[model samples]
Target chain A: MGKIRTRLGDGSFIELLEEEIYEDLVDGTQDAAQKGRIPPLSEDELRYLLDLYKSKARVVGVDEGHECCLSYDNMTSKIERAHISVSKFQQLQLFERALGADTLELAHIDYSYKQVKHVVIYDKPNMEQAVLLTIPPMLYGAMPNLGLYTYPDGPCPNPGDLLPQGKFDEAKEAYAQAIELAIKDMIFVGSELYEAGADGINFDTTGAAGDAEFYAALKAAETLKAKYPKMGIEMGMAGEFILGMHGEIEYEGVRLAGLYPHDQVKLAQKAGVTIFGPVVNTGTNESLPWNLARSVTFTKACSEASEIPLHANLGMGVGGVPLNIMPPLDALSRASKAHVELCRLDGL
Target chain B: MHAAHSIASGMGGMRTTGDLVARLQLNKGMRIEQAKQYVADKLKVPVTDLADSVTMGEMREDLNIGVVNEAPGVAKGIDAKFRIAELLDLDINCVDMFKDRVKP
Candidate 1:
């Protein structure tokens, strides 16, 4: 039998035997099931993947609704990084006029709220046309970073050094301190941006540093929402499951660690998040069929449970899209289509 | 410059074939030599030609997967992926199923 052409989760082009495809689908579903404790794809859904791969068309599309609007996390910075040499506002204009992005985010290259807190003056001029000021609640980038708490840089003993000595409490104490610092920075930056004529504030890539980071974002969101009732806030998650890096962190009585997208959305709503971007990590070795099925299943549940708009994170290494920095459109379109069609997505 | 080129510039230049070779090595566990050979076979180019940016640039332009230099109004980003899908004969499963369910 001839091999069917397909792409790996990393967006690498490859061909595989029919049996290999089946094996990948099963493995991918089981992987998601084990990790999230969620139901696997139904047999019919699995058959859909098998038939889709066996189809003759190379590139494919939905007959309708592929032209849906998009919302971006770090819109202007991505344009500037591409060496576009345009002003930040012009980059937003380009996305609106050329790329048709419905909503745009104006952000600094540093990309973290702690870093952007010092640069809101520069970002203020770019606030027009439904633009949100975006920044990550990057606990890892905060002052006295975990590294600073350890080693030659600071007076405190190194956590890594302490961990081997069974100083788990010391290591966790350092993380707890970092989370408090990050929350302050996020609230400060978000308030500064909101006051500067911005339409919204996006806490991009929340939970990247795990539960402590997620806690900081939720707390910051709660504070900011109470302060400015009209300011739109979007919390885009870093992964499907919040990592238990600082496993003891809680937001509003619900523990932050190990919460899946469905559960995560509930916390976001309680914290007054206006939009939620739930991510499903892609497996580099799995086929797109497996990845998309897994991502959709998780995101569908998230969308159903979400009170806010569900802007599923459909980008590199997440959302069943390939891990390519410039994700090939085949995967992007297919992933977007599936999320919109199968899941109740507001934007990609 | 085409808008897609502008978008592609920051996201990393049209390194589609090179990216493919690298992913095969990194993800598929192919050795460097094996990955290069595999990419060469799929792309129908000489193995040595893979590293030649000038040659690869033209090949990418021709293939419409993406290009180091922009060809005005041609594919890039999502448009490029459409061409890549057909050129590479990739089965984007969602696309296939959607087409089947919707077609006359």
Candidate 2:
């Protein structure tokens, strides 16, 4: 029997017998369905991943019409880490002209709306170039980092520090205060960057701080859209399931905490997000087939439910790709292909 | 400095200090030892502190070079690199560009 080439969730290479592939795929899909309370993949979807692994080609890609554009979350910051000496504008240009990114973002190293608010004046020149110079659309991206409001950073007490002390009301109040502060900062910075010539504002890594953070992003996006009807907003999630740090928080009458991607995209749509980037975290202990199957199942549900375009996150440690810093292209490409083919995704 | 850095590098493919050192070596074409010495001098610490996570952690917290346990109000990820560029006096292209373009 021919050994089928595959990878583990860490991006390590391994080979499996042909018979083992079916079992792995089924286990992956079933796990996702049970966890998310969604349907498992049908036989046809399983066949696509099966053929992808069994194919002789080393790497895989989407068919002609199935291709999707990519929207990178932290454009400028990642460039500074990799390149020895590339100007932020030059790095953007490389992404635009050289790399052909469909959408480019201008972000501060801090990667948070509150932090970027302080530096937007310094970023105006870069934002202008991002809009005027680049052929693709440009966005100003940042996290709604509500954590900055906690003690040692801002006036509020840390919820993590308080909850253990039997101070539930205080913790909830802290998150609530942080939400208001974050909403204000996001609006102020989003408006400033939008005025500076950005095509959109991206709330990258939304809901990372918890339901309160998710609530803030939704409120900010709604307010920003009301102000600039033409502006595009993309919300990329930090995880598949929204953590219920502030368990009772709600947006549009839907509870924000403990939401899976399928439900998460609905709130995003109501908030007028132009693109929804849903995340399905990769399981490090699982096989690539297992991870990819689970990722595709969740993403497919998200795409179906989403009225806006779906740009599922396909980066390392999420979207069924491995947890490696540089995720192996074999697994990455196959996962991307499966997402595009099975999930009907608009972008990555 | 020598043994410490190599041991840390072995833990993960590349971390903050390791990444910075490797970048210096590749970009400046310095020998590994020369690159280590250069980073050590720039950060204003003993050479051995480069790989000493505890010392580097404190130093990173102070300098905003990058912190492992990220907290609020601290420089992180790429934000740390901006400080690194200014302190190290290295020619990071984007930082130089931002400096040139900042409005007054």
Candidate 3:
């Protein structure tokens, strides 16, 4: 078993017992189910599963001996302690508040781990203070070029339209500048490039046009890689292709194999694409429970077969698990931790 | 930040009694249908009667099922009911009613 060290609220530290951790996992799963939350695996079930990978698993619970304290500086110095049995609904509310709506909606909550009895709170170098900054396309009016993209139907609109557009030359410059800024901010892990459709070279043997889009996206990724050589560059084929679109038959017959082609994975590995994943989830209904499970399973299989570091978008409504029912934040956190551990075990 | 947030934002602007019941946290009642029945039985009235009382335009409009802003007078009644319900592990409807009645 691996050991993890974490800081507590009172500037103290304590180690977490595996038994307590397992209990928390069970409670988290039950709470999530009661609250109608969507998670990859139930907390308890995941805990049991993690035990199978105990040799490779290392978890450190910070502030395990102290009370969970949340500091709110609104007039008075308020501290909210963790509840004994946090519900999934409460977790959803906290996630929405802490992570913000856009980020929460964009990212999927895989699993979380919590201390069963002790509330660990961090004050210095707060890990909970992290924020997700999205870098919009630089082109003045660059639409996401959704002509070949597939999206699910729902209240949430397709974000493809959020891209900027302008003269191709100007757009390239702007994209370059955006990449530079992203690198500076340490947020541009890789480029999420769009392809014309599943028929494009990125996903098929046709080697169609729209090389400009792919080139631009690829160049941005390369530039980032040159600066952060040790960092990863992930090339997202069009959302449609990654999603196995172009009809079910197309998906079953060719698109599926084409999307995760052995050659492309090898090519990306050679090209120094540190991590690559076909963006699987997009649109509103795309984050359904079944979709999430299928995507995780597919991504895991792809990673194992390709021997490459592949990550699913797992953000919000796209390629990530969707939560229809809200659970306690503690449960969600535990569930997320479990999910990440599972992914590691399954090589996702 | 205010109490009305529960009714306004939390409830997604739903005004019907069924909607309110469906959103409330109840132990035994997991689904909307079960919640409706639970509320009807607890209120000592038929499901239709309870629904009608909750759905009546005048009553629904006047009822403030929102989170309370002030505590002294407005939140006390709801707080008492909430504390009791929580202590006894009872249905949340009792607290909801107390809060609704206290809403001006």
Candidate 4:
């Protein structure tokens, strides 16, 4: 395994460890943060403790929300629901905070840091909407050309009024600029991350981009993938919401129903996406004993569509926490077993 | 001049000498010389280490934070991804790397 040396609180460098005790420490930290327990460490102290902790721990990439946090509807519509909303600068601040963290050990345990650090970016479906944040001022000047549905608190456009209605020039230019702004934002707040080591910049697109803006986002992804060939942008095609058995389809005059992204996987591959298989959602009625049968059918649909690897998104909804957290223990136990049993699932 | 600054700024913000002196005394109960040495020690350099370009993340990390919880979904994400890595036989070290080079 490759190694990363993290400077500890005492200014001693230790090999950064990934996983093992990291889960418990982070869980405890979240619990503490929630219960008003962990006090703010002075920046130096935070830096030292974070590095010491970073040396040993393994965990997943955390995402509070994608477009859900940055979009206009996210601010107005979901505000009452307690959804998170933050600007690009705020996101840059968050990235700094997270890097300072990097799965540090709180209690006594030995875990080493691995050399490779993962930087995955999710642009909600048509991340083109990102320009709405009023960032980079240049965007403010080039506003009309970007092809966003609407700006924050601005008038919504009727589909008829959306200019050029999917024309390449104006919309594409705006998308390219949006992505550039995103990258620039990342660099502005944290340049050392790129310099620290070769970070794998996985530019994954989601269904949140949807049909209206997906092509624009994908074009940007393709351009980025071409530019930064080393980061190797991977495509994560978000599947359409299908109700599984409750949904219906007819093939060869026979009616059949289940869950799947259907032919959408082909569209992703055709768009130069290396990673196939659209992400399958559980369903509308997210009830207990989550329709395991439907999940199997959904997986089968994705499998039939592509031979590429799959990341089974395990959580459905963790009701009532404002932010989704803590899947039902029973459901999680079953999901764990399913993850192990499904050899085809390369990840979650 | 450099010696005076040594006791200053590193405590973060409040660039004035008097502010630095007051802050050091209030927090660490130390004199200017002691604070200067503390800065040097933190920098792992001599008292006359001077100045250099600091990265963006470094500057933010040096600033104060009320609490340092991991980003929003990071804790749970780690747990989920770790299990996924174990089951998939993928490298747990890199979140972006899966299936040899593909990031899931």
Please compute DockQ, using alpha carbons, for every candidate against the native two-chain complex.
0.02, 0.01, 0.01, 0.02
Among incorrect, acceptable, medium and high, the docking class of model 4 is: incorrect
Query: Candidate 3: deviation at residue B32, Å?
Result: 44
Write one digit per residue (lDDT tens) for candidate 1, span A1-348: 889888989888889898887777777777776777777777776666666667665344433322222456667677788897897756655654455233446777777776666776666544422222111110111121223323464444555565577878987887766666777777887776666545457887888767877887888889988997756677888888888865777887888889999999999889877767899999898789789878877887787787666667887899887898887765666666556766746545
TM-score of chain A for the candidates in order shown: 0.87, 0.97, 0.32, 0.39
Query: What is the per-residue lDDT of model 4 for residues B49-104, given as tens digits with 9 covering 90 to 100?
Result: 31222321232234321223334533222243334234333333223332334534
Candidate 1 docking classification: incorrect
Query: Could you tell me how far off, in angstroms, the CA of residue A297 lies in candidate 2 after the best superposition?
Result: 0.4
Q: Give the candidate number with the greatest lDDT.
A: 2
Report the C-alpha lDDT of model 2 over A247-289, residue by residue, as the tens digit: 9988889988789999999998898787788999998888899
lDDT of each: 0.63, 0.74, 0.29, 0.29
The parts of candidate 4 lying over 4 Å away from their true place are A1-149, A153-198, A203-205, A237-262, A270-277, A284-290, A318-324, B1-104
Query: Candidate 1: which stretches are off by over 4 Å?
Result: A55-59, A63-68, A128-164, B1-104
Better of 2 and 4 by TM-score: 2
Sort the predicted structures by TM-score, highest score first. Answer: 2, 1, 4, 3
Error of 1 at A326 (Å): 2.2
The number of the candidate with the highest TM-score is 2
What's model 1's TM-score? 0.69
Model 2: per-residue Cα lDDT at residue A221: 91
- Give the Cα-based TM-score of candidate 2 against the true structure: 0.76
DockQ, cand. 1:
0.02
